[model samples]
Target: MRRVLDLAWLALLVFMAATWQFMPDLVGAPQQAMPRDQHMAVMLAVAVFGVWLTTRGALLVARLAPGLVNLPCRDHWLAPERREQTLADLGDRLAVLGLGLVLLFAGLHYRALQAAQPSWPQVPDIAWTAGGVALGLIFALWLLALMRRFGRLAPVTTPRPVRRSSRSRDLVWREVQPVWPLLVVLLPIGVGVGLGLFFRKADDHEAWLLTALPLLLTAALGRMVTEVHGDRLTWRFGWLPWPRWQVDLDEIVTAEPARSRWIEGWGIHVTSDGRLYNASGTQAVRLTLRDGRRLRLGTGEPRELLQLLKSRIAGD
Candidate 1:
C-alpha cells in the first residue's frame, strides 16, 4: 500500500512537470520571461522529487522508537550516564531546526519587499543565500553532534554471556559471516558518481552529482547483505568485508524481535524489541524456542530460513 501510494505520488509529480513545461508562460510571470521549457521541466521534476524525499526522510526520523526503547535483560549494558546526554543532544538538534524555520519565516517579508519588482520575489540575494547556506551547515553539525551522542549509547548494548547445558533445546542459532550484499551493489554506483564528477562539465556535474548521492547511498546499502555461518556475525563492504561481531551461539538466547511488513519500514532496522531485524521493504518472520528468548529476521525466504536455522541448531 505504501509502495503504491509512493508510485502514485511520483506519477502526479511527473504530470505536474509536464504541465509546467508546456505551460511555463502560464506558470511563470510575464516580466521574468519564460525559462526554456525543457529546463523548466527538469527543474520542476527535481523540485518535486526533492520535496518528496525530504518529507520521507522526516517520516523515517519520526519512526525511531527514541531513548533506549528496549531492554532485553541487559539494562546493565546500558550507559547509565548517557541517557540524559542523549535526550539533551536530541533537544539541541531539534532547537536548531526550530530556530532555522523561525528565521526563515521572519525574514520572508523583508525578502519579499526587496524582490517586489523582480518576478521571483521569493528568491533571496547573495548575502541571504550565504546566510541560508550557513544555517544549513550549522544544522548538519548539530545533527552530527546528535549522532555522536547516539553512537555513545550503542556501545552499551554489548551482549552478555549465558550459561548453557548439554541437554537438547529448541533453539535457532545461526551467524552471519560476512555482509557483502551492500558492497556488490555500491561498487557500480561509486564508479558512476566518480565518472560523472570527473568527465562532466562543472554545471552538469554538480547537478548529476547531487542526484547521484542518494543512489550511491542506496547502492551501498544494497551491497550490505549478511552471510550466515556458525558463531560469528560478519559485516562486509567491498574488499574490507569481514566479521564485525562474533557472539557465542550460547550467548544468544531467544532473539525474537517484532517484524511485520505491515509495520516495518525500508532498510535495515533494529526495532525497539531488540529482536526484530528488518533490512528492506520485504517479508518478515518471527523466531522462537522452548526458552523465553526470541529472534526475528526479515528475509526473502523467511519460512525456509527459519527451518534451516532450526535444523542447524538441532544438529549443533
Candidate 2:
C-alpha cells in the first residue's frame, strides 16, 4: 500500500513538472503562451531525457572508476539494528507530519481560491496545480523519511570498542585557505538577499519567509568544524551543533589521503561512492568502512590525519 502511494505521488510530480511550463496560464495570468498540452509534452520529454542521461553517466562513471563510487551501506557508524529502529521511528513521525501538512495546505488553498473568485473555469486548473504542489511536498517529506530509515542500515560486523581509559588524543585541522568554504556558505545568503530585494513589494507574510532563508542557510552551512576525539570522528557546522554525524573507528576498513575537486564543493553531501562531510581545502582523508561505504573528511593536513587515524585504529 505504501509503495503504491509512493508511485502515485511520483507520477503526480512528473505530471506537474511536465505542465510547469504552462504554469502561468494555469494560474490565470495574462500572457501569450504555447498550447498547454503541447508545452507539457515538450517539457516532459526534456525532463525524461535529462534524467536518463544523468543516470547513464553516473553508472558509466561508477563502472570505470570504482574508487570514486562508494558502495551503499546501512550503517555509517551506528549499529545496524539500532540505526534501523531509529530511522523507522523518525519516518513514522515525518510521514504523519507530511500528510497533515499536505491536507492543511490543500484545504487552505481551496478556501483561498473559492473566496477570491466565485468562478467555475479557473477553479479546476488552480485546484489541480495546488494539489500537485501539496503532493510534491508530501512526497519529498516521505522520501526523506524513507531514506533516513533505510540508507544507513548496514550490518555492524565490527562493533565499536569501549575505551577503558579516558585518555584520548585529539587531532584538529583548520582550513589553511578558508575563503572557499566561506564563499560556499555565503553564496546562498547572497542569492536569498537578492531575491528578497527583487520581491520587496511582496506581502508582509511572504516577505518574512523570504527574510528567513538566508539565516536558515547560514545556520546550515556557515562554518565547518572537523574533530577527531579518541576513536570517534565527528564534524558539524559551527553555528548549529545538533545535527552532527560521527564515524566509529572500529568500522573504518582503511583511511588514506585523498584529493577532492573544487566542483565537489564543501558541505554534508551524499556522493556516488559514499557520504562526504567536508568544510574546506581539497586535502581530505577518505575512510572506507567495513561495509564498503566511504567517508571523506576535508582537512588542511590529510596525510597527517590519515596516519593518526590508522595508528589509533591499529592500537585499538
Candidate 3:
C-alpha cells in the first residue's frame, strides 16, 4: 500500500506539471457550462500551498535538526543511542502524509482540469471541501499513530511489582481505574454534542475528531496508582510507564493536601504552587522537596497518603 502510494504521488506530480505547462491545450470539453469561480480557485491554490509548507517543512526540520522535532517521550527518542532511528522513523511517517496530500490535491486538480480546454472546469465547491475533510482525517490518524508509537517509553526489561515481603513492602494504593461503563455511556453523547456544536455548513466534521481525546485519555490512564517501595515514592497512570513519577521521600520537607484554583484544569501541568499530576479530580497530595520545588499527586485517600508521607519524611 505504501509503495503504491509513492508511485501514485510521483505520477500525479508529473501529470500536474504537464497540466501546468500546457493548460491552454490538451484539455477536453466540460459537462456543463458554469462560470469560473475566482474565490474557489484561490482557495484551492492556498490549500495546496499550505500542505506543501507543512509536510515539506517538517521534512526539512527533520533533516537539519532532528532535536527540534517534538516527540512523545522525547527524552528517549532524542537520546544519542536512538536519535537516528527516531529521525528515520518520523521522516517516513511524514513522507506518507506528503504523499497523501499530493494524491489528494492531484485528484481534485485533475477533476477540475477535465472538460475545460485552455482553463480548468467550474467544479463544484463541495469537491475541495470534501478533500479538506479527508485531509483532516489523515492528519488526525497520523497524530494518533505517532503518539501511540513514541508514547511507550518503558524499557524492555522494566521492572514491575513482584511478591511483597515484609522488608520490601511500604505502601500500595490504587485510586481508580476508569470505568468502561462511564465512558461507553458518555463518549457517544459527548461526540453527539461536539458535532452539534461545531458542525458547519461547510462540511466541518472536525468535531468528531474531538472524541479521540477522551479515548486517548482513558487509554493512557486506565488506572491511577501510587506506591512507596523503601526510599522511593513512585506513581503512574494506568499501565503506561513513560509518564511515571518518582520522588525521594528522604528529600521531602513537607507533605499536605494540595490547594488548587479552578483555572488549573487537569492532567500534568506546572502551576505557581508546583507541578500537578491529576487524572480526574482536583484533590491531590502535595509534596515539597528540599530544593523548594513542589509536586502534587492526585489521590482519593489524601489523608492516609499525607500521613504516610509525613511519617516517611519525618524518619518514622
Which candidate gets the maximum TM-score versus the true structure? Answer: 2
lDDT tens per residue, model 3, 222-310 = 56667866566887775655456677666677788886655876565556565687656667888876544578887767887887777
Q: Is candidate 2 or candidate 3 better by lDDT?
A: 3
Task: Please give the CA lDDT of all the candidate structures.
Answer: 0.44, 0.55, 0.62
- Alpha-carbon TM-score of each model against the true structure: 0.35, 0.48, 0.40
Name the runs in model 2 displaced over 4 angstroms: 1-210, 261-263
Candidate 1 local lDDT, 1-316, one digit each (tens): 2333344445545554444423433323467544456545555555455544434443334335333333222232234544454444344345445445445433432353334434332443787888789888867765554444344324323444343354333333433322334445554666666567557644554545555765545434443344444543223322322212223444443433234655655444344433445555355555543323344555565555555545444445
- In candidate 3, how many clashes are counted? 2
So what's the TM-score on candidate 2? 0.48
The true-versus-predicted C-alpha distance at residue 114 of model 2, in Å, is: 13
